[model samples]
Target: MSTEVISQIDVDRTRGDFHYPEQHTFDAGTGLSHATIDYISDVKNEPDWIREFRHKALDVFLSKPMPTNWASKDLENIVFENIRYYLANAQRPTRSWDEVPDDVKRTFERLGIPEQERKFLAGVEAQFDSEAVYSNMKKALGDEGVIFVGSTDGLRDHPEIFKKWFGRVIPTGDNKFSALNSAVFSGGSFIYVPPGVKVKHPLQAYFRINAENFGQFERTLIIADEGSEVMYMEGCTAPKFETATLHSAVVELVALKGAKIQYVTVQNWSANVFNLVTKRAVAHEEAEVKWIDCNIGSRLTMKYPGVILKGRKARGEVISIALANNGQHQDTGAKMIHAADETTSNVISKSISIGQGRATYRGQVHIPKHLKGCKNNTECDALLINSTSRTDTYPAITVRGLGNSVQHEASVSQVSAEQIFYMQQRGLTEAQAMSLSVNGFVNDLVREFPMEYSVELKRLIDLEMEGSVG
Candidate 1:
């Protein structure tokens, strides 16, 4: 395709409407204390053991100081006492949208989750504030040995499976945010596919932040048994508030022997949100795992989706795209660790910065010397819409063993006036021309998304580009 077409493809066609929810009252108030943690546990009616785990995690969260040397400096300004730890919109997940509280149902309806779920998804869960308001699974998927529900429901109904893998991939003490998520996390998806089963349609979850001064810490877990396959998608949005809100989440995935798993996230939180999330997966013998991550609209985002090749011949791939607007900073990347022989991994990352926004990529690819026949490929590209926008690339590679192959490439450039002029000459508006160029920049990665999602993503990007023109 021509450059014009390529760029146009990057621009979304959907004129995205900004729909903000009316704020509500939900508070546990003031810092990481025993009483606050207990209040959260009691609100959820969680079992004693799980509550104990939360208290332990809360201790860890308090003991660890914020790491100042990391991706962004915004962490230092976050006030722990200013965030509401929990809010329950519903006592339990519901199978019907009508069964959800009218207010919460209106929230998801405005966000398009219900319509999208009915048209294309196999399962859908909608979370309002810190709890899932509605969750439903198609009968076909239930008959085919697929389980999809909120993490809370999983803990109550599938205790054996949930207990075995809850903290296996990402322990509570793995990092400060992980600890925080473990302590107060709520309203995330839980998925499992029995061996040899395949979920043909995607399972989706939507997260909405409807309260002011609230923190949304959601923990998600997915397991694909041997020879099984599944794909999951997540969408996030929040009301625009003057004060910054916190959204720290942990997501873990396990792809067992001969299984495949794909996890995709399309984050469009309001610009007042701090999106600090930890996501990682383990690929066992001959297993495959992929992360398709898209980031946009957050005031600051520091996320890195990683994978571990634990068993021989496992494969991992990360495809990421980030779009940063004025007053926004997107610092995102990926990590790949090769622990066994014959493991292979790939990373493709793209970013776009407009107005005064800045985007950064920090990544790692590690292959221990003891591992043989391991290979990795990494590519990162950044596009700046103007001179004021900034982009940075940082990649660390450690190769220990012999016979390992690794390749890395990176490029950064501002949009070309010549290209814009050429596109305008072809009958497109300046904004449309810019949109087309941005779309083309990440066309390949957009193709990896489910058709419905790709279409929506493209439209969102286009709407973002509307007023971005000088």
Candidate 2:
């Protein structure tokens, strides 16, 4: 929603098309149980509190039921006992690229991470399977009291800062998947910017899933101290496996007084992957938190990035783009809770459904009677590319506060057959004509994406159209 643009997405369509042989030194065997919990805690040498926390979360996961809504029926297909909870090849992440294992380095090389790190990013972490193979930050940032590393390292090394806000924004009982992620979480990132420090370049992480019937649960936490600012971008990918793969991640962000945090996600999972994630942020007085998200490929995706405006004049925003292909369902949206006076929130979402795909936008905004001068604006737009494709929008906005105001707008349209035929008559193929039409439909939102990623998104949409229309 903000004009602060992120850098080019290093990984794209070809990023996870190939996978190397699996050679994990550590693998928590299939199934979930207390033994699995013990194994994970033992392997990480976690503190007793963390171990206890995991046990509590697992109990919550078991006690809770899968969502019963129509949008969640597909979730029943996931066999929890059949999924491997964790797998990793390394104990500690390497800071230098030369120190990284050849196989791990090769995996990152294919994603263009090294080049991107050198060109645009201030720091980078490349997570493979359940652990980070490489994690590094520029020295200038470290000198300026910035802490950037894997969540594991964050928990063990900087407990003072990490423990303060960890799991505070989004609790374990937020949902079943969240509880599940909290129980078996690994990798992801932890970033802390000291007061008044503004990171000049964005930090980035790439999560790659390389095993079949395996689940990757990465946990991320970011805290910007008073008057500080930071932007983080993450990309996820998994090879196309015949058996299903599960990716469930949890992200929590905290922005202190007058601070700012921008989070960007580019997800491109394979067709056999289920991408379910929970992300939320807390914005303190005069602080701001924004989520820039894009979803492309997955069998099913259910994610809603939310923010709680906890202090006066706080702001929250989300700008999202989701494209669903054949046999895929994209269920995505945002949530905003205004708890203080004069808070503001905005959401702009655009989605495209191709072939027999389905896309749904579900959002929520709440302002209690105690608040005053709170405002919210939400817009959801969808484009369908085929007769059988489908789209839906659900917005739940409650404005009970004195002088509070809310605005919501939603629209759905289909590709014009006449326009496609006319473009075809001008010598363009069906896919080309379809690409032009789809681009025309989403260009406004694409312009809001980062420069190179905007181009990459356009290309990805064209590729999807080719598969559906050609």
lDDT of 1 by residue, 1-470 (tens): 69888555543332122444543344567566888888877777888989999999999999988866555777887888888888775558889988877777777776788899879999998888888889999999899878898988888888889989998998999889999999998879889999999988899999888778889998999999999999999999887788888999999999999899999999998888999999999999999999999998788999989999999999999999999999999999999999899999999999999999999998999999888999999999999999999999989999886899999999997789999999999999999999999999989999999999899889878887986996
- For candidate 2, the TM-score is 0.96
Looking at model 2, residue 299 earns an lDDT score of 96
State each model's CA lDDT, in order: 0.88, 0.91
What's each prediction's TM-score? 0.94, 0.96
Residue 88, candidate 2: how far off, in angstroms? 0.9
* Candidate 2 ranges beyond 4 A from true positions: 1-13
Model 2 residue 108 CA deviation in Å = 1.3
